[model samples]
Structure formats: C-alpha cells, structure tokens
Target: MAQAHHMRIGEVAERTGLSLRTIRYYGEVDLVVPSARSRGGYRLYTETDVDRLQLIKRMKPLGFSLDETRELLAAVDGLSADDTDEDERAALAERLDSFEAAIADRCVTLRRQLEMAEEFAERLRRRRAGRAASA
Candidate 1:
C-alpha cells in the first residue's frame, strides 16, 4: 500500500490559502484537526486535511457561520464513510441537499449585490467623464 503524504502547517496554509492563525483556530474549533504530529510535536496534515480547510475557506464568502460549516462538514463526512447504513446515508444526503439550497440562494443574492455595485461604479465613471468633458 502506498503511504499517505503529510505536510507541515506552513505548507498546508500555502496550499489552502489560509493564514497560519486561522488554520490553528480551525484545529482548536475541531473543524480540521491535523492527521498526525511530528516527532517534535508539530502539527502534521494530510491532503485530506488541506481539502477540508479549502472547503471552509469557500464557505466563508457565502456567510456561513462556524456552526453551519461544521454541520455541512459532518454531513459530507458521514456520506463519505464506507460503513454508513442506508438510513443514515439518506439523512446525510438530506442535510447536504439543504446546504446546497442555501448556497444557491446565497449565490443569487451575491450576484444581485455585485450587479448593483457595478452599476454604481459605472455611474461614478460617467459622472467623472462628464466633469472632464466640461472642463
């Protein structure tokens, strides 16, 4: 069997685009605990751990709270487990569906906000151009 690759905290941060402090806080919050420790007691992470951090980073822009991110991660983990029974899998699927719906709604709202901001910026540009023309 191939051995799993491991990385230290700094590499994980660079790969996941998360700050060192944020990664440590996620560990403290039980969001993405390291997969192992080095002989010197430094935190060691696997590729899977980096993936989880990336997921959390994506959730941040969508206004997901820590609790919500945790819940979603739980559902995803449950679904991915090999020993999950049919009934449990169904429940986890339902939870994932709800999260998907919420994400879609948030995306729509974000698009609307982006459109408004763009419109405002265009208006400002037009005003500036008018002033330049008059001068």
Candidate 2:
C-alpha cells in the first residue's frame, strides 16, 4: 500500500487559508481531525484532511452552524464510503439534496442583501456628489 504524504498544521493552515487556532479548534470539535500526530505531538494532516477543512471553510461563509456543518460532513463521508449500503446511500443522498437546497436559498438571500447594500452605497455616493456640486 502506498503511504500518504503528511503535512504539519502550519502547512495545512497555509494550504487551507485557515488560522492555526481555527484548525486546532476544528480538531477539538471533531470537524476536521488530523489524520496523524508527529513524534513531537504536532498535528499532522493528509491531503484528505486538508480537503475536509476546505469544505468547512466554504460552508462557513454560507452561514452553516458547526452542528450543521458536521452533519453535512457526516453525510458526505457516508456517501463516499465504499461499504455504504444502497439504502444508506439513498438516505445520505437525500440529506445532501436538502443541504443543497438550503445553500441555494441562502445564496439567493445573500445576493439580495448585497444588491441592497450596493444600492445604498450608490445613493450615498450620489448624495455626496450633489453636495460637492453645490459647494
């Protein structure tokens, strides 16, 4: 069997654009536990671990709570497992679909909020310009 290459926490943090503290916290919460530990007791991660952290990072911006993120991760893991039975796979797929729908709804809400914020900023800019013109 081929051994997977491992990275220390700093390297994983660099790759995932997450702070060391955040990574450690995630590990504590079992969101993205390290694949191994070094002789010196440093957290060591594999590429798969990094990928998990990246997924969590993406989900964070979508406003998923930690528990929700963990649930989604569990569903993803179940779906990916080769030993998952067809019945389990169907349930996991259904969970994934629900998450997808929630994400899409959140994204639409975010877009609407962003548009309103931009419009407000534009209105302010126009008001400033009008004041300057009169000055």
Candidate 3:
C-alpha cells in the first residue's frame, strides 16, 4: 500500500467517518493529533495518524475514557521492531488484555443501566394506573 501520502484535516475527517469538530476534539484531548501542519495552517495527517484515528474510533464505542485512550496510544508508541525481547512483547500483551477487560466492564455497566431504566418505566406505569383508578 502507498504509505507516502498525507491528508488534510478535512480529508482525514471524511476518510475516518468522523466530523471535523470530533477530529478537533480528539486533537484537543491528545488522543489523535495531527502529525504536522501545512504552510497555510491546515492540519496534516500521516498514515500513523490515520491508524491512531482508527484505534480511537474503535475504543470510543467500548466506553474508553480519553485518558485510557491516551495510555493505550502511549503503549502503542512504546512498541519497537528492534525490541525482540519476549518480556517486552508480553508486557504489551498484558496491557491490551487490561484494556479489553475495561471495555467488557463498561458493557456490563451499560446493560445494567438499561435494565434499571426499564424497571423505572414499569414502576411509573404502575403509579399512573393507580392514580387513574382513583380519579
């Protein structure tokens, strides 16, 4: 694939399916910042930035906080091809497992919240019927 290309912020947004505002927000949060800027002050993104954006997009739906996302990106940054050490690869794998666990916990929390909302609605319906019968 062609890795010798750059894109402006607009094109990055289009390719990533993220809004311009969201891309800017990610930059502000230090989740996915532009690699460089054009002479005209436009944000320039490289292939690495595209990959980071993809990671961020995937993590967001899993309810990852910006801080957690930042840490994950830092972990990604720490990987090196020169480091053929087993310990280093094992450490990275452990961190990824932790991230996955966090996402799973968030999914459980969301399911609980949904269940609570449903129960609350049913209680509200019961109260409404009780009031209607007395009226």
Candidate 4:
C-alpha cells in the first residue's frame, strides 16, 4: 500500500538532507513537489516524495539540469509494469547511459577541484611554517 504523506516540509527537509530554502526552490522549479498542503497551506510530503528529494539530492552533485532531471525521471516512469516494449527499453537505456556518463565526468572534475584545494592548503601551511621559522 502507498503510505500517506504525513510529514510537513520542515521534517522532510531534515530527513532528506536538504535545506528548507532548497526544498522550496525545488518545488518552485517543478522538481520534487510536495504531496499535500495543510489547511494553512503548509507543505506536506509522503515517504515517496522524500525519496524523490533524496534522488534529487544525489543528482545535484552530478550537476544535472532540472530539465534533464525531469526527463530522466519521466523515462523511468514510462516503464510501467505491463507496458514493456523493447524499443522503449532501448530508449530508456540510452538516456540512462547519457546520465551515467555525465555523472562520471562531474566526478572527474570534482576530483581535480579537490586536488587543487589540497595543494592550496599545503602551500598555506608551508608559508605559515616558514614565517614561524624566520621569527
């Protein structure tokens, strides 16, 4: 059975490792939308909706565009249980491949950034040590 979406936006924010501002912005951008609203219009989220947010969180680091995110989700959603066709499966596979490649590329870029940051930190440490020796 599909569980009821019981949690408010703040709870969802905490559970999903996202800021409230980021969650609201995701809603505004038509990413992971809230499942319900309170009588006072406060947003509520289902477990599934929170799961969606988690997926979005994972995607964010990979630098996927909102439209690409939507498209990838749509491609997976298109694979309804009884609607399986080879052509559709092939299309979905192709889209997934593209997303995988993009994520891998971002990982390499991030590693390079980390290396640069580490080098900068080492330089600062060396400079501090040199000044201390001179003093």
Q: What is the TM-score of each candidate against the true structure?
A: 0.98, 0.98, 0.68, 0.83
TM-score of 4: 0.83
Whole-model alpha-carbon lDDT for candidate 4? 0.86
| Per-model tally of clashing residue pairs | 0, 0, 0, 1
Model 4 alpha-carbon drift over 4 Å, by segment: 80-84
**Rank ordering of all candidates by TM-score, starting from the highest:** 1, 2, 4, 3
**Candidate 2 segments whose C-alpha is farther than 4 A from its true place:** none
Candidate 1 Cα outliers beyond 4 Å, as residue runs? none
The ten-residue window of minimal lDDT in model 4 covers 73-82
Residue-level lDDT tens digits of model 3 in 12-127: 89889999999999999888878888799998999888888989998888777888899888777766556547787778768988987888898899899999999999999999
Ten contiguous residues with the weakest lDDT in model 3: 75-84
List, residue by residue over 42-135, the lDDT tens digit for candidate 1. Answer: 9999989999999999999999999999999999999999999999999999999999999999999999999999999999999999999999
lDDT per residue as tens, model 2, 79-111: 999999999999999999999999999999999
